[model samples]
Target chain A: MSDKTTGNTTGTDNFPQENNESVKREMFKPLSRRSFMKAGALGALMIGGTATALLPLRNFKNDTSLENFFQQHYERLTPERMERILKRIEREIKERHGVDANVQDPKPIADVQFAYALNISRCIGCRRCVHACVEENNQSRNPEIQYIRVLEMPAGTFDVEKSDHYYSHETVPAEGKYYMPVQCQQCENPSCVKACPVSATWKDKDGIVVIDYDWCIGCRYCEAACPYWARRFNFAEPNIPKEQINPDMAYLGNRIRKKGTMEKCTFCLGRTRKGLLPKCAEACPAGARQFGNLLDPESVIRHILREKRVYVLKEEMGTRPKFYYWFDT
Target chain B: MKNNYKSVQNEAVPEFIRNYGLFLFQAIRLSFRGSTAFYAWMIFLSLLSFFGLRAYCNQFVEGLITTGMTDQVSWGIYIANFTFLVGMAAAAVMLVIPAYLYKDEEMHTIVIFGELFAVAVMVMCILFVTVDLGRPGRFWHLIPGIGRFNIPVSMLSWDVVALLGYLAINAHVCGYLLYMKYLGKKPNKLLYMPFVFLSIAWAISIHTVTAFLYVGLAGRPFWNSAIVAPRFIGSAFTAGPALMIIAFQIIRMTTGYHIGDRPFRLLRQIMTISLLTTLFLLGCEVFKEFYSQSLHNSSARYLFFGLHGHYALVPWIWTAITFEIAAIIILLSGYSRKPGSFVWLNMACILATVGIWIEKGPGLIIPGFLPTPLGEIVEYIPTYNETMVCVGIWAIGALIFSWMLRLAIPILSGIFRKKNE
Candidate 1:
């Protein structure tokens, strides 16, 4: 049993011992000049190789400034600092895309909780809102990113599995089908905000779930945590054509995003906070989209909530989404 | 206790610090000296790592588009590897438990290797996570005071804390032992014994926390199961000991040390029980998913069978299941006592290790993102660049483990010791 306990040693014949003994002798020997020179040369080669490898970083110098790198989180920044950042962003945009962008940081209005109501019954699957959103948000064009996805569900069932996101009907909403455009629910209890390891996203006071793009580490944990599949990651650099760039940008809203940050529907806060309709609402050919402050008792969204059979998507997930969907009333 | 007192009394603090510096220098020198095979292996790993770095550089320049991940399937093989290595790091506790808890002399003699293995695995886990990040340069943003660290709410924050804490505990415990041995002094029980128990519990926490990182996501029903944590522990136990069994054999052969058969037998026995437990947990998950047939079970269906005529993971999961079952059968064959059955045991270990890696890695992560929340099916196949990065991480891990062994084996075998100064 004792001999068997040294089982691995018995297999030493498989491993040549002559080399190991020599290796040991080499280790115990005094530091030889030849070996020292070899080590020094190897070290120099590694250092030089590393320096050469890092040369490509020079290209990134145009985007990654020291001020941008050390910028504080959005919530912590003072108004003056925010103004400075906005100016810096505009300068960067001007330099990169040759667009004179107006970058602002709009705070949520007092006593305003923005809510959206989409009339699914009146919705046509024309996909005009999808394109309008992309153009308005300054989203990438080549690797196309559209915030809203219009799922064509059969009239008989609400099961999303049977719905077709890639339906090519080549006409208006096909017979026996209804269109439901899904975007960020702006959940009161958002899973994405909770899942962020860095608190780069939060639910704003006015019910808009916003992301601090500068602060986001682009982990995409928030993307995985969103039940609505609302979040979009910039897998590559967002390439908005120079003429197509949206100049009316807010820091927390539709500002041009860097590659590797998370972006999503901010309830069109750049427009909505300033009392303008979201581009999707404005662009819908049919009167299928409604945007209003839910806090106003007489608002259209509040009226829909009180009278219409309004339902939130994935309500069973307990996400308390401010975005409501309802049939014609 | 008396030996600890004598050392404290005799060795001044300055002398001790000086001795530690010399010991580290010697270790660095010794790590550089190895056989022809060792140099060949290190060079091969270094080349792979260099290629991996170039791939990563391309990824950095081009963004994550270089990988197979899309907005639909956001995470790919990097996260899969990170999840697998977290379990690997946690498994070292199996050795720690026997050596320190049960007072097994054989295990006590060799448990440092397991702790060192944990350190090496933690490095890989960190590397995998870093490579997976979209903004790896923004890593300092996770620093508690400097950047916002969402704790208590985000299970990932918990995972970061748990993984780093486990790394520290294992490093301290084993590093103290090795340094003590090199100094030819008895290890102070007060310094490391408490940490040993802490590390045992901490090991379980790291894996449990990692499991929670997935299971806490209510959006992905594929991961939102109560049994995920237990399954993680079970599979981690299986894979960790299997690696140790093979690694100990290599150590014994290369270093010509008497590692004994007891550790191997004990690890084999562990592999047997944990393999059964892991399979049982897997069966429980399958039964729940298939029997109930809820809408939530679509991910499981996609994993086991096919969904919407897309079945990339079906063959992979089946292969993993086959490998795990075959390993169990071989381990339970009762031929472990015979000296010549080492070949069969080694085969079983390799099979189990690979099986568990598949069971936890791609088989778990990919399926969670399939039939996505809105029920769209987009398949993810890892790109070649991403594959090389994973291979690079694993090669770096192996390199670290080898280097640690180089420094450790000589001291453990009493060849390198402090002179009587």
Candidate 2:
């Protein structure tokens, strides 16, 4: 891909003649340094303007061609290409944003896999997961963009027993029910991907469904399509105070998202890709949340899935969610 | 001498009174016809929009945190308006299909009017969506081949295509018809069949795609149900056709022009069927939710009844149900079929329109997100700015509707009268 632009024969003739002519022309002119400098600046200005105009067009083609080659949706990218892309992403982030955002490229654990196991019994309905998600995913402080929600279900009934959605009090788990936190299940067969007429979002190799925020058009179709209600729309500019903004961002998953797009949790892919546990997993003080690679047999997630008789939130839908929950036996 | 004096006085008084009255009427008429009244209305809305726009700017600057929406209730009235107006746009096809395809003579006169309404509503829908977005300017990113097309994976792509296609079709057909009328030429017959078929297909596509947006969500149990698509179609037709009826009545009352009783009666029948379908669809959803009594049942219960102490949505839901029932009752009565009863029926239809808007719009999506997957409940309340922005968009739609009718109605009346002549 890089060779196509650099090695193209079309520019070689023009460049050789142009460089020789410029040198010969300079030798013949023998102008003072000041005059030569002025001429050079003028020439440079003209070249700069032309380049600026043509740069966008060239970049446009490059982007499209690159996207075409890389366009195997999300799941189709091979490991080698994914790695290269990750490296390229890290480089671009550093060069453009001037931010030291960590790009994760964790090797797939051989035996130890990752899966999310939620402990329904110990959940206090504090919604710490929701907060952690915002911090982890670098979400806009706009209350609407939360990637996870912890519903306060009442005792004896699993309904959305609202003790107070705005529960800011010191003592939580207020009286009746256990809290349940819901985020993207990273479904094995995500309906959202199927419903998309345009393949703007897809499950990456790491079992995280990621949306190219740049590609999303803020249509809310994904928001409506997600059975988990995991998708969120950036209705307004995400306003994380500069100080609070999470510096560690992912290119496709958790980079600072713009307005007018759909977003959801990618299991903190920005962190997980770097061999770090998701922020929500880290934030759960009660050990109610556990995340690990589902592909690893020796991982904690596999142990929980095997020994605890874990169940998915909505198994009847057959989404095959990677997230699981088990009662305390 | 006395008789002459009396005759002169009577003649002078009657002539002066008649001429003065005519002058006053003409002045009022001129004020309405020119840009004065129009600009006045524009300025008034602009002032309201100015304040709303300020709030919107604040929202953009401060972030969505300024809104009443919390994590649990991610969507609010903006989305509801988006859904409602899109349905309105689809419903415009009702006139397009009948007039162009089936060649329904009764509908031919009003078909362009319907298209005009569609253009207006679509504009409104698009505006509401823009306001709902975190970055409204990025909307152009959906243009294919230029921006990314996440084919088979993103509904946003489909929505952009469908909406743009529908708008283009409406614009082409309406613009051609209007130009033909302006030139005093007959509308080209060749365009009719293609347009008719397209309109029918397009109508279904718009609503179906909108439904697909919801049904595609595999995570939200309430929205994941199979009934969402049918319910959307049912409610859209009901509310959309009903809105058309109300619009017709408003035109009649304001202009003293008539669209004939037959079309009104025909629309009433359409509304009835739509309303019944909507009610049935709503019932099916309820039955499935309650009968299964699964985890999904809680969101439904919370919406219908106060979940815990938060009773905010319950009253709204009950109101929608009551009004919908009342609308059905009014439509079912024999008196409603009469020409004189059209006004009352229109009122009922208007109520049904609002009822469905509330039911399908905010009522559906907000509660579905309430008991978040983690069993957390967060209340969603739309702020005053959100409400104002909504009203501002509605006003823009109304403004578009008014102007489009101003242009189309006179031409329509002329065409119909010419045909008769």
Candidate 3:
């Protein structure tokens, strides 16, 4: 009701018949002083119209402050500036979700490129990893922004066209189907990074693609660019239960995201940057998910590449994704 | 004493600047408390526009979830309409090309209407982009110095530059010419002729860059074609001239502006050539997609025929194709040329307008994401919010065009001068 009457227009169309008649009487008055008054009234209407247009920003002004406006790019920020941002995140997490989160900014190690591999044969169709990822990533619960989607496809072929996502069956892992979970492949030549008109998202030296959420304008060009269907947008304010908020957070990883921003699986940067496994890998009951440094000669990903027939999705597009899938046969 | 002070202030301003402000006030004054029918039309559009504004507020509060788009069909109603409107904006160049190049005297008389229409469409284009943005508050991110506009890298950035530049050039040209017309003075050719020439190239660039927004996406095979840019220009030409021809008749009825038979006849020829080109381009695109049967052709296949029993878009694409074909036959026939055949001409024009809108809008943007990146077909049905907002944006455009016409007609017909005489 409040938004319905913008511009003090009092237009004849929205009114009752009696009211419209009166408005027409008022509208068809004589010339001279009235014309100037009408111009003045119209000027006021124009100003009111502009104010209504800007009303959406009022709810967001405090969240994205002057500091956020002036904040340097992720790569350009000094150690002190980075520390201030990390502290702000800590404060925001405590206030919004009532969780005392340790929001850190972990720099990439020298010459260590991240890689992932998932074994299709051993994987079960259970969706525990999907829920676990949401809680771990601090994703919204109201509209439910879950990062990972597991597809159940026919066993004979891997054609993505025939896959089903909204499945409900009697038992785990149906007879003629194989389950494959898909997320951001963290492409070495990530199109999402190139698609960001604001340079808000980029790949670090570690080949772990990340987004500076504060800097992002939420154009969704990146969302459209990703071939893996990896990106998720925050359409409204994220509504997460206070008790369930993840206390361990990373600035570019699983920290609480704002409304109208894009979030995706960042490989659990809070844990993985400390040399721990991604939650999806750790939660998989069938030991299907593998995460390791692609450059490390002894890493499991390197061993899988050397010993097995491994493949990346959409090879012709040449995204050069770090995530890979393999079969034991 | 007050008159002396006012006169001193007035003398400091340049004569052109003084007239610019004076003519704007005159235009505004003319727009108020129109005739009963005019009031009815204005009120109806205003009410619809306000309802649209209210719907946007709901969208802002409830998030984009209120709309029926998911990650699968990420860009929906807002984007589809945006694509069609850019074609509308670029259509003004058809008026410029014949008037300036061939120096056709009748075409020269109506060129201001096209330039003014471009300005209105430009406003609509910017509004659609803002509404589609997830964080509209962060609009400053596109401002070059304030934030990063990754020019030459992102096609979106290129589109922004092209669109805004076209608006500025056209607005300047129209403003200069119209203010001069109001003052009964010949416009200085040097001041505006250069910009008018530049706007022709700028017009083509706006739609081509918008096509690049979709074509550059390698992941979506549906849009990854060289055919996109040329098809964009062709469809734009067809729609633009067709709309202008209809508009001329309406202006004659409402404002007694005497546009004779020559103008509409010339525009009909332009429309025939461009519509044929668009249809031919469509044939090539369909044949390539059908013959090769590449995996990328799934979206095109989905458009023409049913894909996996998801036949929603089947009717829409066919209707558009049928309309275009029917309109062409009507134009090619002598019935359109017969005296009192305006009914047939109006039907053809309406068919072309709606057909091209359908072909460029939902037919182009939606099907591109049908078998999404993950090969899932989550069909998009634009929710009430999407429809209302879409309606509101269009009403806004109509209101702008109506107001521009309302303002221009009085001056063009010389009623103010006659009254003085």
Q: Whose TM-score is greatest here?
A: 1
The CAPRI classification for model 3 reads as acceptable
Residue B328 of model 3: what lDDT? 94
Superposition TM-score, candidate 3 onto the true structure: 0.90
What is the RMSD, in Å, between candidate 3 and the native fold over all Cα?
7.6
Better of 2 and 3 by lDDT: 3
Q: What local lDDT score does residue B75 receive in model 2, on the 0 to 100 scale?
A: 68
Residue ranges of candidate 2 with Cα displaced over 4 Å: A1-184, A191-200, A218-249, A252-271, A274-308, A324-329, B1-55, B97-102, B253-258, B283-295, B338-342, B413-421
- The CA lDDT at B95 in model 2 is 70
Chain A of candidate 1 gets a TM-score of 0.89
Instruction: Give a tens-digit lDDT track for model 3, residues B1-421.
Output: 1232243248779966655655554455467856667767876787678767867877776667778878788888888888988998899998898888887666766788889889988989998888888877777778898778788798888998998999999999987776665676677999999998999999999999999998988898889899999999988888878888898888756644556566677778878888999999999999999999877888998888968878889999999999999999999998787764478877888899889999999999899888888888988899998799889988898899888877665555443211121
Give the per-residue lDDT digits (tens) of candidate 1, residues B87-192. 8899998989988899777787678899999999999998988888887778778889889899978988888899889989989998998888788888899999
True contacts kept of each: 0.45, 0.28, 0.37
- The 10-residue segment with the lowest total lDDT in model 1 chain B: B1-10
At residue B58, candidate 1 shows an lDDT of 71
> Candidate 2 lDDT, tens digit per residue, A1-329?
11122211111121234443443343223346875575576457545544542332332111122542334433446887767766666665455446666665443334433468998887777777788787777787744467776766667764443333455557887776567777888888787766544466776666677786655545455554566777777765556666665676666767776655678888876677668888888888888888887777778888888888678876777788889988784
Full-model lDDT for every candidate: 0.86, 0.67, 0.81
lDDT of 1 at A276: 95
Ranking of models by DockQ: 1, 3, 2
Q: What is the DockQ of each candidate?
A: 0.43, 0.12, 0.25
Please give the C-alpha DockQ score of model 1. 0.43
What lDDT tens digits, residue by residue, belong to model 3 across residues A1-329?
A: 12122211111222334643443354334465966786687567656765675465455334666687677667678898899988987887777667898888887878788889999888888977898899898898987988889999988877888888887898879988999889889998888888888888888878888988887877788888888889989877888888878888889988888878888888887888789888989899988999999999999999999998899889889899999999895
The TM-scores of chain A alone, one per candidate, are: 0.89, 0.68, 0.85
Winner on TM-score (1 vs 3) = 1
